[model samples]
Target: MKASELAALIGAELNGEDVEISSFSSIENISEGSLVAILGNKIPEDIYSSSAAAFLAKKGADVPAGKTYLFADDAELALVAAVNALYPKKHRDGVNPAAYVADSAIICENVFVDAFAYIGSRAKIGEGTEIHAGAVIGEDVEIGSGCIVYPNATIYDGCRLKDRVIVHSSAVIGGDGFGYYQKHGRNVKIPHIGSVILENDVEIGSGSCVDRGKFDNTVVGEGTKIDNQVQVAHNVKLGKHNILTGQAAIAGSSTTGDYVMIGARAGVSDHVNICSKVMLAAMAGVMSDIDKPGIYAGIPVTSRKGWMREIAYVRDLPNIVKRIKDLEKDKDA
Candidate 1:
């Protein structure tokens, strides 16, 4: 695509001689024939030396001498639009001959079931959904339209995933929750009879697990994006648009309000309710309910101010001890 064509497609203004852009790249890794994103108001000094065919940048950004520029309100977003327009995804439909789909399973139109994929009894695959190779959709599972179950991903029995959901490779939805009871000095497993419900536009990252509920369904609210290796325990209700970063774990029965952001490796105790717009620092541990919305940090997370004060006190511990000893000696003398 030419720079002028891309600008027209992405609603960008062309500001230089139109150049043929065969591929897309970033400013850090500029290629000879690729269009690169040059963000921010001021152009970078190093960008002058880049060999990119065209620059995708903000409206007021200065274009490099003799180079084409596609100006947009938001360079990043426009770049995304340009990339999608330039490289469209290929749609693959129809069940593969080698796929194992039960006779009772309902496969919707425009859906694709790849080879080695398993669709159990009474499963209903929605239109425009793709069940990739090696994926397993258990009995009674209902996957909505435009969803993609990547290679080896599993949606256990009775689970329902809403429209536009993306389950990455190796993700296991509706797995058994970690619930046990002590019986005769041994651990007895509690059966998870309930399933998981992934709301619309929710994404389950690779290697993540969402445990099924014990009684009621474990629900992930709409637009929540969970990162890789995260864990959502049984009966936990995650609110809409929540961001659970990599390795974060929420214990069973916990509920979160909308827009809560749990940092990487953060831990939320069971039964705690986290209010909306609360942001936890990486590795922060929540022991109880967070009523107010604000930034929190540390193990057993406190307010950002409290965490900073604690850090300061710990840093002056040796001096504090020396001052205490000096006062004691003066009194004794």
Candidate 2:
């Protein structure tokens, strides 16, 4: 397609003459006839010298002179649009011959079950949903329309997923929660009978898990985006639009309000209640309820300001100890 045509299709403004774009690429490697996406704030120094058909970038981003550009207010959205237009998602509606779908399973219209995929007994595969190869839909599971269960993902028995939920490769939903009790001397395993509910528009990242509840459902609210390797423990309730970054974890029964963001590797302790609009920095350890909304940091998290103060004091600790020793010697003399 022409650069101007793609801009028109994606609701972006075209800044230069129309150029034929045959493919798409990141700013790292630009090839002729490829639509290069500039996601960073500053244009790469090599972009001007690179061979590229056109550019897709932020509306006000500086572009190399004489380059054809598609400028959007949001560059990420524009990239999604460009990718969708270039390589549209193909829906293969029929179940493959090698796929094993149980007799009691209800495979809806426009659904695709790839070879080696297993749709368990009594499972309802909704319309436009794709079960990729080696994916397993457990018995009695209810998957909603437009969902994508990627390769090797396992949806355990009795779990429910609402519309447009994307379970990426190797994600295991409805896994047994980490629940045990002390009995006599050895630890006794407790049975987790409850399921996990992934609400509409939620995306479970690759290798991530939402464990089953002890007695009630573990609910991830609508539009929450979980990053890779994240763990949402048993009975945890995450509010709408919460962003759980990579390696972040929520202990059992913990809850967070809407728009909460947990940075990479942050840990929320068990049963903690986090209020709306709170942001926890990377590697933060939240051990108690966060009643007020603000930026937080450090282990056993404090307010961002308090954490900064602690860092400053710790950096000066050696000097302070030497001064104290000198004062003691002077007094002895």
Candidate 3:
């Protein structure tokens, strides 16, 4: 599309001549006729020589020569919007010929059911929703409009996904959590007798597993984005707009406040409460509640500065031990 049209679609301002952008690509791999994203002045040297026709750049972004720029406050988001506008996803409407949708299920207008998809008894699918190939929506499940259930995703019975939710490929929602009891030397598996509730605009990435609650709902609040391979255990309540990175694990009964940022591989202990605006660093092992909002890191997760200081102290342990030994010898003399 033309640069002016693209800017209009993405709500960005067009700065240069209106050039037709055919496709979208990252800055580094962009070739001729592609639209790339320019986030800042620190463009890689090799990417500066790319043959991209236009760039979706943040306001005040330093644009390389020979590219028409669409200026946005958020370049990455603008680029994503631009890509959606230019390439627009083709959502096939109505039931697919190969899908097995129950006659009792309520499917609204403009709903798309792809080949091999299964909608169980009494399932309710709202308008403009797309259920991709091999997706399984269990009995009594309710999914709102503008939602996308990607290929091979599984939404178990009684689960409720609010509007605009995106469940990526292979994600298993409402799956049984790891709840077992040691009874007379044999482990007894506890039945997961609860459901999952994904509020509006929540996007769960591929391969993520959100276990069904033991009794209450495993709730993910509005606008939260969970990265790929993340594990959200039973009864874990994630507040609005939380950003959970890939491989993050929230143990059962843990609740996090709005705007919380949990980095990749960060683990929150069971029953812990993380306050709003808290930032847990990558690989942080949180064992206790974070009552205040701040940056935390390390195993047993402490303040970043304190953790760094402890690391520095531990690094000097050998020297400190030798000094103590010498002091003892001098004292003996």
Best by lDDT: 2
Q: Pull out the clashing pairs in model 2.
A: none
Q: lDDT score of model 1?
A: 0.93
- How well does candidate 1 match the true structure in TM-score terms? 0.94
Q: Write one digit per residue (lDDT tens) for candidate 1, span 142-223.
A: 9999999999999999999999999999999999999999999999999999999999999999999999999999999999
lDDT of 3 by residue, 91-206 (tens): 77978799999999999999999999999999999999999999999999999999999999999999999999999999999999889999999999998898999999999999
TM-score preference between candidates 2 and 3, better one:
2
For residues 204-277, write the lDDT of model 2, one tens digit per residue: 99999999999999999999999999999999999999999999999999999999999999999999999999
Candidate 3 weakest lDDT stretch, 10 residues = 60-69
All candidates in order of TM-score, best leading = 1, 2, 3
Task: Please report the candidate that would top TM-score against the real structure.
Answer: 1
Candidate 1 C-alpha error for residue 272, in Å: 0.8
Tell me which of candidates 1 and 3 scores higher on lDDT: 1
**TM-scores vs. true structure, each candidate:** 0.94, 0.93, 0.91
